[model samples]
Target: KCAQPRRWKAFDGKITEMDTQNSLRGKELLEIYRSINTRGIPKDERTSVLLTLKWTVKEHECKLTQEIVALIDREIDLMSREVKECNLEGLRKRICTLFLQYIKIPEFNPQVAGLIKVPQDPLKLYKNVYFCHSCEKYLAPTEFPIPANSHTIGRCRSCYQLDNEARQREAYFKYRLILENLRKSEVDYQDDSKIVFLVQLPDMQYLIENIWNCQSALSACSDLYDLVMVRWDKQHEWSPWNTILLTKEEADAHLKLCNLQKTYEAPFIYRIEQKHIRAKNYFAQIPVMSSFLHRSSNQSNAN
Candidate 1:
């Protein structure tokens, strides 16, 4: 009988040789690996890859690292829906490597285990140490104030606060409260993927003070606590351009507003649109806001 060909080949002197690593199929797989984190791919393919990854992780039932499993599960759930972004490349590669480590090689299985050892004491390595970019020091995870749904590791909360006070001289306590309330009210909104985290306290202040002129659009109320930001179009995500600042009572009325064309005058509609355009122009400077804008534009185009 003829000898079976090896699935992988040794690295040859030539980069273009038909060795395992140099083969066209191997290059294609590498290209896929590189693109696993890229954003321009179609959503269906992205969804499929994540789903297959989750299934593979489940099938093996690997116990060495629940971290990868947990991350995979989270990404799968997050990417299953049509959202603005999917940036989980680091987690994806970590998952792939761990999965590869478990594959039984003919004679190198023990060598793989040696390289990727199952820890003798797992708890020893899982310390919550995080490096604060602002302070240039490693601190505990408690030093940072990460959002509930965010994978971003940011500067330490102390450093963030210090910078905000010293440089920005901005008050975020009120904005923080507003964000907390908004996130808490997500159940009522039915969609919880708004760009709330990207909107800094300073940005909120700008939108309120400069854009909306520190008063409710309807009642002209100036009390910051009494004023609340709500969606202009209830079906769309609440963004700077898509929001209206109204007093507690006015916000209640606005939320219950069903027919805008009938409820408000033509002049009022024109004024609100003017405010939206102003907000769009103002927030367009922020890079993160572009994704929300893109998402909004795509939705509008689809409709």
Candidate 2:
């Protein structure tokens, strides 16, 4: 006798692929198999398979599941009657989204718990969490713009962005890029430069807009792309007071100068010194910088 073609004997008697595909529970398993196997299944067939799998997942019997299942059934009915794929696009997307959310729940799908990122220690999870007033959400401290001098945690970066859009509409991306470049350059210098890292986005914006007037000090070039902030005097490490805004070409020449006093006229040197004084006065307001200023004064007195 020929072997029964891949047949399984159930307690009732026998089970075949056709028998499994016809029953409701067996149809769900078949749909899952088709969803997982993408070799020859068409896009629409795969979508329908996924929709079937979404409602059939074990241990997920809730009102939300019922609503989604109803929606999927209605879409299937409409597709059968008219087959308008365009009209069902929105419904398909909603079903897929709901299914994704359904799978992400650890209770609904215990297998996914290891795949998702969650703090192993529950106590540590809340340690660095901060409250964002604007969004009224508790977020990580990294989400907030906490400057060196910030005494209290204010609104998060997202809230600040929303506030900017509503009011100032000012873009700080260019300034942020400039500040990052400055920090990287300072790190590469290998000198014990302390100020650039301490400076935040707002400080960089203030130095550029208020002190330098958003132009190259030497050539008065208004373009920010060609401009770079570098040490005014090569012997000293870069600080707010010791830096100059110059075009890339001008910066190379400026750094190469044997003597700034002789290379540039007295009037130009005087103007640069005035800008340095302004930077010193502005940054001195910070408590950390105040100590630095005090140490420098003591060293100057000692010398």
lDDT of 1 by residue, 33-55 (tens): 44455567776787676555555
Predictions in order: lDDT? 0.66, 0.73
Model 2 clash pairs are none
Q: Please write out the lDDT profile of model 2 over residues 1-303, one tens digit for every residue.
A: 011123567888867543321233333443454354444555577556756565575347887677667766777687667666667777767766665566555555444455665644569678978898889998977899999998999999998988888644344776777788778878888988887888888998899999999899988998877778988887767888889999889988888898988889999989988998998899999877887667656765987
Q: How many backbone clashes does candidate 1 have?
A: 1
Checking candidate 1 for backbone clashes, the offending pairs are 9-20
Q: Which stretches of candidate 1 lie over 4 Å from their true place?
A: 1-171
Candidate 1 residue-wise lDDT at 275: 92
The model with the greatest lDDT is 2
Candidate 2 TM-score, true structure as reference: 0.44
